[model samples]
Target: MAYCGNIRQEGCGKLERREKYRLFLYVLLIGSITALFICWMILIWEKIPGAIHIRAGIRQDLDLNVPVSGKLYKAPAETEDGAIPVTGMNAAVDAREAKTLSVDLAEPLTLYAEDIETYTMDLKLFGLIPFKTVNVQVINDKTLIPAGIPIGIYVKTEGILVIATGDFTGDDGQAKEPVGHLLKEGDYILKVNGREVEGKAAFMRQIEESNGEELVLTILREDQEFDLKVRPERNQDGEYKLGIWIRDNAQGVGTLTYLDENNSFGALGHGINDMDTATLMNLKNGSLYTTEIVSITKGENGTPGELTGVIDYKESNKMGTIEANTVEGIFGELNESAASHITTQAMPIGLKQEVDLGPAQILCSVGGAPQLYDVKITSVHLDHDNINRGIELQITDKTLLETTGGIVQGMSGSPIIQDGKLIGAVTHVLVQDPTRGFGIFIENMLIQ
Candidate 1:
């Protein structure tokens, strides 16, 4: 009886050992599966675009895709009317491209999507899945803009802007730049001694009145406002100075691209960067006046050219108030008289996908008048640079080439019309090839 009982105990111990081994295998399989899933999520996150821009009622094919098992969901929220619209489309097995992501809009609306996978089968990954945040922007795909009409751009910074900083010898024996650290080129002098600084002269007056005491300066730099204290020093000329050259405003000539029914207009396919500092000009308040072309410097190989014009800044000739200075262009509300300048009825705007490599025409004020000029699209480039270069074009119009030797400086905002729609705007000309230039898609300009 003792021998039989011992055999039974040994058999039970073996059974227990087998069960432990089985459990180990199960846990190992699950852990291996979890690690693989994490790797896949990391790869996907790297592929997603930061944001997507598309037109209203248009279809935009994303350069991204989802896993075969992953799904897409858009979260709806309140949006401001007339605000720039953008949204992500739902996910589905693309009938043509299999499981890729695509965006299609039926109306002018914005959508947001936390592109995530909600898998519940067997593993119940649900909220464990990682996602990438996406903001989709949808904008009006069509609009009308005034072409060829020159606009006088008068823009002022928030305060007297420091054009440059220099060293100066003060009343003290030691040499110092009193504006050091507190001021730099591109910094705006907003206030002195708590008094609001309006322009260059106002800033100087405040400094002079400070009586060489430590003046509290409220300065604006890159959208950030800060307070600084500096003692103004007397120079050899017996004048208190900050030892910085400043400017109150900047003026230039730009072509008007469009005037919408809402009275909003856009021009100068790119922002106006300071010539001295090469920084995008920040706007405080500005005016757009009508401009009459006074002269033109025709373009040639290895050299850029420009249009010289006189701005009609009289109250009666003021066309609009400068609003936004953007990469795509400057936009603002136009006065009633500005409407008379543009007769090009508002037309549909063409998206990037619709732009083809073919013949097109441009409306530009090459020689004091807006006229239709022919151009041929040489190539359509997927943008790899900061500026939008939708298409490469070569001048084909004999009139434009003969008059300006191709696109000149003043033609930067000239609208490119194709198939009865606005496709793009002339942005830059190639110095090597006088007839060739770059253009930004009109859809890009519209969103701005």
Candidate 2:
């Protein structure tokens, strides 16, 4: 009986050891979970201000404590090696509750945050492992510009453009399409039957002279080149026809936005679209000539009005050479000073964030000259970062309303200034109201 008691006591000791082991594991697991949660919260704190811009001579505070609460330190934005100085500001940082970092701008400068690292102490390093960049754009605000100047733009597409095609009587005496889906609205016809075609007349002459044979077409679509075959059909007049409408050039009048420090100009807040097919007119080479306002078409409900203007034909009136026709507008280098015509009033750029809903001014010319008229910013929608309609505005100037009725067609690119800053430009007028219009951020134009 004594031997049995000894064995039972030994078994009890083994069971106690197993219970202690499991208890220790549970405590360790809880500690690990807590540490992981803390680390996660700090990681979120590092994602403050994806981008920031400050004008020269201004102090801006960046709050870095919106996410997890932790001790902060001076960390490199791009790498972990050396410190990149923030231009135009005090760079010394205090290692404590790093909630706010102040930046003072003296000149235009950009700094990345790679070498900056957050540490709990001098010995332990922390912050984002890969680090993130802080784009501290220190730009000057005041830019002098001439407003309300008229511009005549002419754009020639990269190649002969196919606008429309229809069916024609064929050799078999049946109505059939010679050019079908192989040609589209925006496609540029580069070559026909191994010969380069220059314009609509050239393309048609080449096709009709094909002797009713198959014509091989070299096509260019959105910078991509391919080849397709199109058959020529003889019409009832005994003449061969490809039955495709084409255009290679477009011209229109618009308002000039602003002249940059480098004498480059941006105009037409939106791109020029083919009025018939409604496709954006692609630019191969283009020019912007000076223009004079001719007449005004009053806008009413359901119909939008426009400013009718004429392009100056005199060679001395040539304003600039256009290089790009983008979604925002057409950009080009100025041939002369724009301030020579209108007021040389220079203003700073009002960022999209700085635009407020209130009374503003739009510089436009309807008949006589470029003038500043009162308008009110009605609403702002930031659903997209790149679209033109960032703000909705309504005309309030009595004289402007009496003269042009509202924003006119050629008023596009009229500069919108609020509180001495060039905020945006007129883009489109509301068809229903005729007195309200859309404005795009000036930063979009500057980017192009």
Candidate 3:
């Protein structure tokens, strides 16, 4: 009986051991699966694609307004104060003879006249027919015209005087002692000493009477007003002179080379120049004009891109110029004269529905830097926005990318075509990773 009992006990122990082993196996299997899943997730996190980087350059034809020194006139007072009673104070020229009339401001405390009660001062030419009428206006009793009031005038001007004193350098790279700092291309002369000069003649007369003495000039820079003491120098002709030139006007146009799929239209792939000083023009008030894409000059390695075109003055009727370009390009309203067909079409604004990783094309002109060419979409990231993200495009169109380093300047706004649909506009190009770039979803641009 004892042997049988011992046998039963051993058998039960064996069964219990077998059950424990089975449970161990089940736990081992689950642990392995969980570990494998964690490893897979880590790999995916590392392999996920990044963002897209793009570089864009846009060009547009522009007509800039150059501000010239007009005249200082005594605007009349509107109220019962000591203010002068004046009228019309607008910049104007004789429509018939093209003569400029000058009016002097008899008062000193007034800055400018109010717009409501302005009058026109008639001037007699050769003491016969009035050649020009000056615009003059009155000021309110509370408001006072600052020390210097800009007067408007019309004259056949040549260049401007660039005055500089102190230790200055010349274009020849040589140092020379300056006379009084003369008028620069961008400086607006407001007054000479305390006397109010009306026109260039009066300015010249004041200088002649000063006899080469140090003169105080109130000039307007940016928006703030300041004063500078300039002493005129005697030239070889024994005439007192300020190194300045006068310019009449300027006119030019460029192509609408690029469009930010994210923004509407941009312009001036570059900046404007002051012909007199050969420097970038210091802009005050300027406007943009629309033009037809006449032609383009392709860019090469080391060379810059340029768009050549004629101004669409007729379209200019509908065109609007930009007020500022400091932000992401310049923004402006379109004119009714804009191409009805182009303006009527809907523009792409944000990310496209689905861009295929196959083939695409760009719309640009020959001689223009951004030439349309066939390229292969190597990969399309499902979601990405970084500079290294976005779509991966290969230069399958060897000729285009070769002539222009994959994507060149002034090609920022070129339309990207894929599967007979507009995808997005090129926004950036990776300098180090030239083969890769970024684009803004066409849908994103339309929002504005």
User: What C-alpha lDDT do the candidate models reach, one value each?
Assistant: 0.71, 0.72, 0.44
User: Candidate 1 at 53: error in angstroms?
Assistant: 5.3
In model 2, which range of ten residues has the least summed lDDT?
Answer: 116-125
Q: Pick by lDDT: which candidate is best?
A: 2
Per residue, candidate 3 scores C-alpha lDDT tens digits across 1-448 of 9999999999999999999999999999999999997686444323221221111221111111211123322234333333222223433333443233333222221123333343344433333533333444332221100000000111122222233324434444444444334444466566678554455566766765666799987865555667788776555555565555434334454323233322235432233445555544333344555444454455444454444445544432335554443212233433333323232133322233246667887555435233457867776543453422345565557776555556544445455667655565554555654545555444333322
Q: What RMSD does each model have against the real structure?
A: 12.3, 11.6, 26.8
Ranking by lDDT: 2, 1, 3
Worst 10 residues of 1 by lDDT: 116-125
| Residue 318 CA displacement from its true place in model 2, Å | 2.2
By summed lDDT, which 10 consecutive residues of candidate 3 come out lowest?
A: 143-152
Task: Quote each prediction's TM-score.
Answer: 0.73, 0.72, 0.38
- Best-to-worst order by TM-score is 1, 2, 3
lDDT tens string, model 1, 1-448? 9999999999999999999999999999999999998897565544343334555555545434444222222323432222222244433333563323333222222332222222111111232344445544555445686466777789987677778988787666557688777688888777777777778776778777767889888888888899988888887666787788888788988788877888888888888877887777777888888888888788888997778888767888888898998888888888877776677677777666467788999888755568888999887653425456767899999987877888888777888888988888888889987799998877678766
The clash number for model 3 is 78
